[model samples]
Target: MKPRGTFRNTALALGLAFLYLPILSMMVFSFNNSRLVTVWDGPNSPTLKWYAKLFENSQILDAALLSVKIAAMTATGAVVLGTLAGLVLVRFGPFRGRAMLSAMTTAPLVMPEVITGLSLLLLFVALEQLTGWPEGRGVLTITIAHITFAMAYVTVVVQSRLAGFDDSLEEAALDLGAKPAKVFFAITLPLIAPALVSGWLLAFTLSWDDVVISQFVAGPSATTLPMVVFSKARLGVSPDINALATIMVLVVATGVVLSSVWMRRQERKRRLEEQMARSDAG
Candidate 1:
């Protein structure tokens, strides 16, 4: 038992180290003065010049802004549509082709991103010929493509949360003469808000990190940050690229930590309220 326990602990430590070492290396290299990524110099040689340079690059800044806008729109659209789909699938009971619909909702999560990009490109082309909308591929087309994939992730997250939710609260709300719409708006939405938020963040991150799909769907004028990064990588990574990557990593990590902390606090408050209600009822 002692040997097994030691082995388990060692394995866990190794796993964590493996996961974090790459991130740590990237962070360290971001501060390196040398352009060559392979060579690491001491702290005396490390500099923040790349970070400063990144701020001065107007093209990179523009791409970053466009990525943020696209990500925000995609996340919003995904959360709304995904939440609706989750609610319908979970609450609407059995229906014809229910399994088929559920499968379709989850399909994109497992599908290759390249395939999704190709399909969307084809879809846009077809729509152009049939309806004459979206005159040519651009940000709007890229956003639609992102939302299509992002919705799958959102749906999966929301559905997991809804699965654990007790329907009795909803039923009780109805019994107390509350309208269905009111119950949904006040109780249902509030209970699942954390899940929705998580889903939105996940979708946002996915859209922000996407390169292949955006490349396929984006117009010449609309370049996302990932696309810029990819194009830059062809010429070998500049220190500015490293600095930009580091900033992205920091921002994403900060958002995730803050969100987790906030959700935990909300959960704790909810549990305390439930406890007080039980005590009063008793």
Candidate 2:
């Protein structure tokens, strides 16, 4: 029999392969000389035709651009709103209605997208009937919906980071004559910078990839990239879709790699600074 460690490693490898093999296949077939996304004729048949054609597809270009804009707005909104929510929860102790506020802030994390989408749709209808505002569902409604859901994730990330923080550092800054806002900017915000980055990236990805919620909120002409891809996938995969998917995979992978590298560098620099401070004290 295999050793326990060997068995665990084997299982982990198998799990990774299972998850990534389809993505690998998509990447490979993106270069296929054949029109079918699944068929691979060999290295000799690999061509960049699909990739070249990807730019000429106006629908895809429009959807991708709209998705990027929504993701950027959603990420920024989530960061600002979530940071404030996190600060309130951490710093303002035992306020009235705190429990309710916290619960509502986190409800989106566990709520089904279908329920959220339906509820938002009803809300828009009611608002339009009463005030004649938001004439129709489009980018504005989609952005608001994305912010509501994505903010929950950002709040949780920021809250967890704040929970583990050292409060004495903030207190020391205050005792040394720094203002409350100054202390937060100089010490607290810098300390939680990594969490901020992680949360922003998460919110962006969630908004970008959302289908169920976006589908309900989106106007006929305001379709997102994910919606476009999902609709196309129902008709069976094509070389164009494969090329588009490969491009997405590459972008996501690049972001992940760069963020990981940045985090590691920051961590190493922090440790070195700590060591130097200790040596100076000695």
Best by TM-score: 2
lDDT tens digits, residues 1-282, model 1? 356988999999999999988888888888988878778767556799889999999999999999999999999999999998888889889999889989999899889989999999999999999999888998999999999999999998999899999999999999999999999998999999989988998999999999999988888989999999999999887878888988988987897798789889999999999999999956
User: Which window of 10 residues has the lowest lDDT sum in candidate 2?
Assistant: 36-45
Q: Identify the candidate with maximal lDDT.
A: 2
Tens digits of lDDT, candidate 2, 197-240:
88998999999999999999888869999999999889987788
State model 1's lDDT. 0.91
The CA lDDT at 258 in model 2 is: 89
Any residue pairs clashing in model 1, and if so which? none
Task: Give me the runs in candidate 2 sitting further than 4 Å from their true place.
Answer: 1-9
Give the per-residue Cα lDDT of candidate 1 at 144: 96
lDDT (0-100) at residue 69 of candidate 2? 98
